[model samples]
Structure formats: C-alpha cells, structure tokens
Target chain A: MNVIDHVRDMAAAGLHSNVRIISSLLLTMSTNNPELFSPSQKYQLLVYHADAIFHDKEYRNAACKYNMALQQKKVLSKTTKVRPSSTGGTTSALQAQNLPSEIEVKYKIAECYTILKLDKDAISVLEGIPSRQRTPKINMMLANLYRKAGQERSAVTSYKEVLRQCPLALDAIIGLLSLSVKGAEVASMTMDVIQSIPNLDWLSVWIKAHAFTHGGDNQRCGTWKHFGI
Target chain B: MNVIDHVRDMAAAGLHSNVRIISSLLLTMSTNNPELFSPSQKYQLLVYHADAIFHDKEYRNAACKYNMALQQKKVLSKTTKVRPSSTGGTTSALQAQNLPSEIEVKYKIAECYTILKLDKDAISVLEGIPSRQRTPKINMMLANLYRKAGQERSAVTSYKEVLRQCPLALDAIIGLLSLSVKGAEVASMTMDVIQSIPNLDWLSVWIKAHAFTHGGDNQRCGTWKHFGI
Candidate 1:
C-alpha cells in the first residue's frame, strides 16, 4: 500500500503513532512539492497534520494548520469557480461536495481559540457567523463565551434573546435567572424579562426578590415574615 | 422605610453603598430579633448582598453567599411545606414566588464554576439537569463544557446527538466536522455520519479526505489532481 493509504488505514484504526508519522511525512512531501499537490490536497494535508497535532493537544499549532486549510479552501473555491467549464461537471460536483462551509471552518478555528482560552478570538470567529443563520446551539455558545469574557450586558442580552426565541431554553433561562439573582438590580430589563416566560415556575421567585429589593407590597412580605414559612 | 424597603430602593437605584447599609441593618436586626425576618427574607438579604458582590465581580464571595441563600431556601421549603395551613394561602403564594427553582440555583452554581474555569464542575451541574428537561441551550452548554474538559469523545457524541435532533444545528455540525477533521481516522463512523447530513456542501470534503487517506480509488483523486481545481 502507498504511504497515504497506510496512513489512512492507521488513522481509521486509531493508530495515533502511525497517523502522526504518515501525516508528518505527507505534510513534508506536499510542502517540498507544493505544485504536485492540488489545492484540495494541500487543504487535506494541512488538515491531516492539524488533526494529528490537535489530537495531541497541540492546539496553537493545530489552529495554525487549520487556518492554512481554510486559506487553501478559500483560494481553491475562488480559482475553481472562475474556471468551472474547463474542470467540467465532475469538477463542479467535487468542489460542491468537498470543502467545509465557511461557517464550519470558522467554527473549528473558534473552538481552537476557546481551547487556548483566547476568548476574544473565539468570539470574533463565532461572530462572523450570520445572526439569521445562528441555530439555538450557536446562540448558546455565543452567550456562554460572552459570559466568560465578562461582557455581562452583552451576555445577558444574548441569553435573553435565546429565551425570546425559545421560552423553554434552559441555559438562557438559567443565564437570565442567574443574572437576575446575582445582583443586577432585580428591577432592570433582565429582571423584567421573567414575565416573557409563560407560566415559568421560577417567575414568582424572581418577582419576590424584586419585591424584597424594590418596595412591592411590603405588607404582604411582612405578613409572610410574621406567620409564613 | 423599613430596612428591606430601604435596601430594595437602594438596590433598584444602583446605590450599592446604600443597599449594603440597609442589608446589613436588616441582617443584624434579623439576627438580634429572629422574628423580624422570615427565612425567605433572610435568604433575600443574602441574595441581595451576593448580588452586590457579584456585580463588583467578587465571584468567589458572591458564590458563597448564593450558596448560603440556597441553603436557607432549602430549609425554608422543608419547614414551609410541613406546616402548610398555618402559613395560609398568601404564605403559600409567597413561598412559591420567593424561592428560585432547584434547577435555577444549580445553574447559578454552574455559572460560578464556569467563571472559575472549573469545567468539570460546570458539566456536572449542567448534567444534573434531566435530559428531557434540557432545552437546546442546556444541551449545547453541557456539550461545550464536556468539550472544554477534554472529554472529546463524549463531546463529539453529544454534538452529533444534537445534530440528530436538529439538522440545522450549526454548532453541533461544526463540532462534528472539526472532530472528524482532527486526528481520528477519516474512514470511521465519523465519515459515515456525513451521509446523514442532507445537502450539506461539506460532506464531500470529509468523504474526499477519508477516501484520500484510506485508499479509495486513488485514480479518481489522481485525475482530480491532474485537472480538478
């Protein structure tokens, strides 16, 4: 079997040592003979090496390789699109099937940033994804990342937006609830947002906190204090 | 104004110093004259203080206070549930309204862990939430926490499960794509999963990568290298 085939098999079998060895060899071979490898091959080689490094927790290096793959992908798409007819239908099909979407690649890069604790870079990459295209999962990710970065207002807003889209969204609900409970005047916009959740069991809890903090029918709270548990 | 009212007003107005003064007064008064504040009221004081500290980014302190608030809430619930009639309907309503849900409290705790970079603790808290009760946001949160904790196999599995439930789940898809691209053999179940994604532009790329590494008709790849972009 050729080196690539043996490496592929080793990778499929979870042979990290073999996968690493072949990936390095392939990368070196491709690097020395750049013209011999097609753009897609270049992308694949970078990804293979990145994947190997990434598996070893070499995130920074992996990120660099993944970045190069994306660059190759971009160049491949642009140049290939320009000469669609010369490459023909098969080429079109190949191009269409191969190459991760821009969002997918960016997401990978963002994940790398996150692993490295480069919160700002991770947010930047994730933010590149269009808002309308954001799935609930993506929104949650963005919200958490924002929260971690201590952009409290933006984080709370993103979490609330997730709640607005889905009332049952527990993470956002938890996010909002925590934000409400943690000390942002329980009377602000985030506190007010509890009303948006339909019949949420925790709504009353927030309301009570607001009442305690802001002057809401002290007599009722007093009566509870006098006799209530 | 009574201490609670004064504290509430100050907290609402973002007057941290004034809120602190009133809350302290209430706490002391409650300690001196236990009858003056109900368990809920005491819990509210702790939360108020916690909130203030939390706003100041005193997360460790805030977390401690929040934990105490939850302890008070737990004790209050137990005692209140036992003597339902003595407390009356208003008391029932008050108790119900005043205490955050167990899930909400746990979520807040998880937030503290996340801020502390205690990813495993965050995951444990989030995972305690029942799967059926998990909103997309929660699942995403758990998945990410798992990933952050270096539970890659579990992370990829969770991401794929999210994708199974939601084909449009971009984060999960990207997660799977990245997992597939990074180090694991491109020819395994990960590659097979690409077939499940309908009309995704990136499926072919993974298939191509797998095929390239594992020896899938090298002639085709060879031809592509010769003429394909």
Candidate 2:
C-alpha cells in the first residue's frame, strides 16, 4: 500500500498515538517524491497532523501547524486565481474547498489557546472573525471565551445571540444557567429551553429540579420530581 | 485465539467503539461454555466489559457495571473467606490486584456523576469515602467536586491537603490558583508551584505572564515576558 493509504488505515483505526510516526513517514515520502502531493493535499496532511496533535493535547504545536495550513491555503489561493464563490470572499473561495473554513481554523486555534489557559488570545482570535461570517457555533464559542475571560456581560450577550438564532442550543442554555447556578428566577426560562433538548435523562431532570429548588418555585420543583427523578 | 484473547486484541487496537460487538461476543462465549471460566475469570471478564463501556463514554452504564463488579467481588469474598492484605482490605484483597480499588470504583462513579452534571451526587459519593482511605488523589477529586458544587471553602481546604501531601501536585495548585485567578498575591505562590512542573513550555510562560499582568505585578510580568513569551 502507498504511504498515504497506510496513514489513512492508521487514522481509520483510531491509532492517534501513531501520529508522530505517520508524520515522520510522510516527511520521508515527501522528500523521496517531491511532486507526489498537490499543495492542497499537503495542506490536508498538515491539518490531519494538527488534529492528531490537538487530540494528544499538544495545543501549542497544533495551533502552530493550523496556522501553517492557513498560510499555505492563502498562498495556494493567490497562485490559483480562482473566482470567488457565491458565499465566501474571492481569496477563501480559491483555497482548498475540501479543507475546513478559515473561520473554522481560527476557531480551532482559539480552542487550543483556551485549552492552554490563554483566554486573552482565545478571545482576541474569536473577536477577529468577520461579524457576517460568525455562525451560531461561533457565537457559542465566543460566549464561552468571554465567560472564561471574566467578561460576564459580553458572554451573556453572545450567549443570548446564540439562543436567539437557535433557541434549543444546549450549550447556550447551559452557559446562561451556569451564570445563575446558585440563584433563582431563571428556572422558568431554563425549563423552556430544556424542552428543546430531547432524551430527558437524569442530567436534564436534575438540572430542572436544581433550578426550581434554587428558584424557590416549589410548585415547579414538585412537578419535575413527580415526573420521576 | 480464545474469546478473551480476541477481546484483549480489540482493546489493544483502541477499537473501543466496538464495545457493543465485544460485549455480545463475550456474552455468547460465556453462554456456550458456562463452566469454561473460573469465578475470578468471570469477575475479570465483567471488569473488562465495564472498562470497554467506560472507554466508550457510557458513563452511566459504566458506573452501573462497575458497581455490579464490586457487588460480585463482595459475594465472591463471602463465599471464599479471603484474608486482608497489607495494601488493601478484606473484600478488595480478594479481588484482582490489578483491578481498581474499592475507593477507586467509588471515585469513578463520582466522576460519572460529575460528568452528568450531578454535582450534588458527586459530592455525596466522594464524601462517603472514609477519611483514612482518602488518598491524595481522592482528596484532589473531592476538592474538585466541592468546587463544582460551589463549596469553595471546602474545596480550598481539600486542595490544600493535596498540596500538603505532595507539594508538586499540579491539579491542586491549579485548583487553588483558579480560585484567585484574577488576584495578585497568589502569583508568586503560583510561580513557586509552577517551578515543580517540568518541561515548561511557552504556554506555561504565557500563563504566568498573563497572570502577573492581570495581578498588576509589573516586575514579575516583565520578567516573564523577558524570558520570550
């Protein structure tokens, strides 16, 4: 089998710990056949390497590799001179269509920063995203970053934006609920959101129970408990 | 190869996503030859199944299986009348030495509770452990559970116990530092603890730099930045 096939097999088998070996093999193969891969293929390989690093919790290394992949895409786009797609800008449209979006790469980098406890860098990277391109997921992440950075008011605003777009967004609801975890009156609001998420497991029931209990809404708490906690 | 051997190969290959397949195979094998396995082997097989479940993130199911394994051990010990060892106790001494401790099983259950967002249950499970049996790791977990349950003072006390036992305990240091993450006085203390963790990277340097900057300790922040953050 080819080296790429072998790497694919390893990844398919979930052997992430073999990433360093696969990377080294790729390096050797590339040196042997300089023209074996296209720039986009090389970019994809770098992304795979970065994902492996990210999974292994080598956040800083993963972020650096992701940045390299992004840069490579920029270079590819300039050389290709492809027309802009209907959705994104001319520059990004010319880049690898199969690879993750620029915003997604930046988001992943910011996640790595967060894992490394660099909240400031995470927020800076997240906030640098063009407002028009910010998806609901991005808003949720920005909310998380803001919360971690101790920007509670900003987090609330971002989280509300997420909820406004996708009212059933579990992460956003949890984010808001966590703010008032020790307080009251958010119970009714939380209960409304909780209805959107399916599979009312013990976690879900316990959340409502805890919320109502804390909210001093004994009637609601009784109803939740009666539903079988 | 035997069923157990096949299961071992599956686990070694990191194919935990095939847990259900393994579980079914184990079941069929056991039913085909009920007497083929000894009592200890049966217990071991149950532990293996539970481990598969645990690795698959089936926390609720895994906790139940772990509990069943523990109960099986209790029954086995009663029937065999095993003696206590220097390391563990009467009931657990009869168990496989490599298998997790009784306290460890309880800890794992508490971890599942934490993941389910059942902080209260987690605290209760953790607190149920006898003080004499609570190791440094257990204390750290208890501290984390306390922190999650919003019992900050208790969490602080438990974290200090961890630090007292092993001054280089990273989790304990991080736990305490996270409490005063925005404060100044703890920066020096954090730096002192940071020295204990080896292979310090830019991430570590950056954290200290950010902390000192937030703490308004210009001298320390300058020193950290000067080191090439």
The TM-scores, one per candidate, come to: 0.39, 0.41
lDDT of 1 at B23: 65
Clash tally, candidates in order: 8, 0
> Candidates' DockQ values?
0.03, 0.02
Give the winner by DockQ: 1
- Residues B122-212 of candidate 2 have per-residue lDDT tens digits of 7888888887787776787788878877888888888777656544344455567666554333344445444643332232454456566
Considering only N, C-alpha and C atoms within 3 Å, which residue pairs clash in candidate 2?
Answer: none
Give candidate 1's error at residue A152 in angstroms: 3.5
Q: Identify the runs in model 2 with alpha carbons over 4 angstroms from their true place.
A: A1-9, A28-36, A82-97, A100-104, A130-138, A161-171, A178-229, B1-229
Top of the candidates by lDDT: 2
Q: Give the per-residue lDDT digits (tens) of candidate 1, residues A1-229.
A: 2334334444443334335554665566566667755776566666656666776678898788888888888888887778778778887787657544556566667768988999899898778888877655456667889988888787876766655554334335455555554423333433433455332334345335445433444555553342233
In model 2, state the lDDT of residue B52: 73
Q: What is the interface RMSD of candidate 2, in Å?
A: 17.7
